[model samples]
Target: MPMQAAQWSKALLADALAPVYLLVGEELLVLEAADAIRRRATTLGYAEREVLEAGPQFDWDNLARAAAGMSLFASRRLLDLRLPGGRAGKDGGAAIQAFCADPPPDVSLLITATEWSSKHESAWSKSVDQLGVQVVFQAPRPNEWGRWITARLASHGLSASSEAAALLAERVEGNLLAAAQEVDKLAILHQGGRIDRAEMERLVADSARYDAFKLTDAAFAGDAARALKVLAGLHAEGEELIGLMGWLVNQLQLVLRLASAEDFASQARAERLWPAREQLFRQALRRAPRQHWLGCLARAGRIDRMAKGRESGEPWREAERLIAAMALPRGSLSAP
Candidate 1:
């Protein structure tokens, strides 16, 4: 049976190392889990480690050879296999089963997959699970990010209040790698002191890329092409779809209010919109009616559900459609 990656550390401490260990999950978590295993294996006298990349054109025979070959540097060895897509072809599966059936003495195998799901499991994976250990690491849910950030900050000898952690969580979105980097930076800047929300806001404001906010600005400014580029940039930078949707939803709600308001100037002042943003909304509201923004807001909610895995559509693609709807005049062009 497979285990949660978070439980691996405790399991490692309680039990002896298995002859083979398979780790599959999000890239950062999987890499970190593999690193932890490597560290433990090293301390247990598995002094020599060899890496094998199982790419599309890789020879399946190499696994068998690695198991049969003697280690030159140490009595015990580790075979670190990198299986990028997690699917072992028929020959690769057979080779793995053969090695597991009568594995070489004192040689451990560590297989890692950065992309994994139930569909990626195979006979080879099951064989390893039967004879060894398999751990899966999943990215935290949207609501779990703040707690994760708080714990990570503690690990770095820094403390953050709940609000501060939540702020960082929102800023980093659900990207664990980026969150880790930010925590490291904060540790250095604050020297392990407690981080407040204001400090986090400062960091976020300073680091805020033009792409995130500009995505909305571009859409509001009736530039669908620029919005698409900005959205793609945010995606490339590892910003979670849900995070992008959060701001998009906010903008849509603001537009709805502004569009429906009987007194636009008073409402803008009440909402504390800056002069520039008020002007932008005034221009955007002119291109489309209140009903249009309402429709877009409804679509945004659907996108958010998709982003959170509650719906089936591709959130990114749906987001692109939403941007097109907001940026272009009604009936000017259909969403691609």
Candidate 2:
């Protein structure tokens, strides 16, 4: 079985290190997990490190050669293998399986991939799991972001109210690296003081880029005025209609998924929704049927074409109409 990312720290406390370890998933989390593993290996006297970038043209034999050859001065070494796109082709898989079959003494192999899903699993990964450790560092879901931010703030010796954390979560929009940077900035600016929502708003940079995400949230929350205001802001800032439509379409699709489910509570849990976001979706579903969201999504495609010059119409006007249809009550939308 693969180890949970949260359990990795506790596992590192063990006296002995595994011969092979694989860390995969979101880039920031994967990088951080790899860093922790490297630190632990260093402390255990793995004095030498060799990095191998496993790109499409990489020679799989190099892994074996690296295992066989270590610096004369260093008795122990860490082999860092980076799998781009989280795939090891047949040859690469064979090489990894061979390595696991007879892993060299005094050598630790750390494989890190920046992306992964159920499809990424294979025999070689299973081999690593059997011999050592495998971890998937999943990003927090949209609803889980606030809790993650709160925990992260705590790590920086800062305390924030749930509202403040939720605000920060909205600002970052599931970008872990951006969230980390914002938390670091707050720690410096606030000196680890307890922060409120208003203070958080005042302290964080006003990132116009994430307004697209907020646009959908506003619509979901039934704040038509706020949603339209954000849409206008995005338009004035020269944000691409297609870019904005991308997130809008994604969210509408999620709503369709939820609305179509026979069991909403179970589906929400499967989607990893937190209570706040769950409430937002609940209200959205109540206000509009799945067919309504489907219509909006289809309209979004037309806007995409308009933006791309393949269709006739003002994409911005169409986008505003779409937002209004989503944000307003069932009979409240006016013709554009």
Candidate 3:
């Protein structure tokens, strides 16, 4: 059966051994789950380990060879297969199915992929599910995030109030790795204490690494200073200019769509705007007309070209100009 990372502990305790294991996700949670499996394999006398990374140039026969080979040093072995592209192509699928059908008793197969999609639901994946265990790691939703943070803190022998957990949820912005790291830091700083919002604020002040969403928040709030500040921070942090431009284009398109709608509330619902963020979009709508927003998006497109070397200008400078154009007062537009 397919299980999440949280259910792994109980599931592992109940059924600790399996012929094959498939872990699929892009989050660090997968790493934890894989570590658990590795430890259990070691405990079960799979003392020898071999890793096979499948890539464009990978040979499918190597998988069959590894399974059939015997370890000279150890009686039992662990075959760790890393599929970065998440799919076993035609030959790989056949090889995997063959291995699953008659897995070597001395070898325990551990497979990890960075992602799993509908297209990956091939016979190989099905064979693994039938023969072994599959664990998937999914990110928690916004409302469920506070509880996640609380549980993470409790795991480190630390606890936080509901307000503090909420603050942490906001600071990390749904990044589980960041939340886990922050909990570790808090455990060191304030061990054996119940954390509150003020303490959270002090600890998490510099933790807010600027991202596209934060940049858009400043621009939509009409704070030219903060918007430019965030843009500079992003550039300094080595954020890709093309990704930032994509975010700006997306947000401006949303604004353009909302502006054209007769009922903005209905439009917001259609756009799936979170309740906390709807006010920011509405404020941005009031700040600029549809034409102006379109112009900003057009400028973003030019920046995209510059980033791809299709144009002849500095991309970062162009992005700063676009952000300034969006955040400036209503009468600030002079020319293209």
Q: Judged by lDDT, which candidate is best?
A: 2
CA lDDT of every candidate: 0.80, 0.83, 0.79
- Candidate 2 collision pairs: none
lDDT string for model 3 (29-81, tens) is: 66557767877877877778888989899999999999999789757888989
Worst 10-residue stretch by lDDT in candidate 1? Answer: 203-212
- lDDT of model 2 at residue 212? 62
Can you give the TM-score per candidate against the true fold?
0.60, 0.61, 0.60
TM-score of candidate 1 to 2 decimals? 0.60
TM-score of 3: 0.60
State residue 39's C-alpha deviation in candidate 2, in Å: 1.7
Q: Tell me the spans in candidate 2 whose CA falls farther than 4 Å from its real position.
A: 205-336
Q: Residue-wise lDDT of candidate 1 within 1-336, one digit each (tens)?
A: 898756777877734478888999876667667767877888888888888999999998999888888878757888999998888889889988998888788998999998899998888899999998899888789988988888878877888889999988887667565566567556655745677898777655523343566678779878789788877777777778887788899989999888888878669878976444665687789798887888888888999999999989898888888888889957443322
In model 1, the runs with Cα more than 4 Å from the true position are 207-336
Worst 10 residues of 3 by lDDT: 204-213
Instruction: Tell how far residue 42 is off in model 1, in angstroms.
Output: 1.5
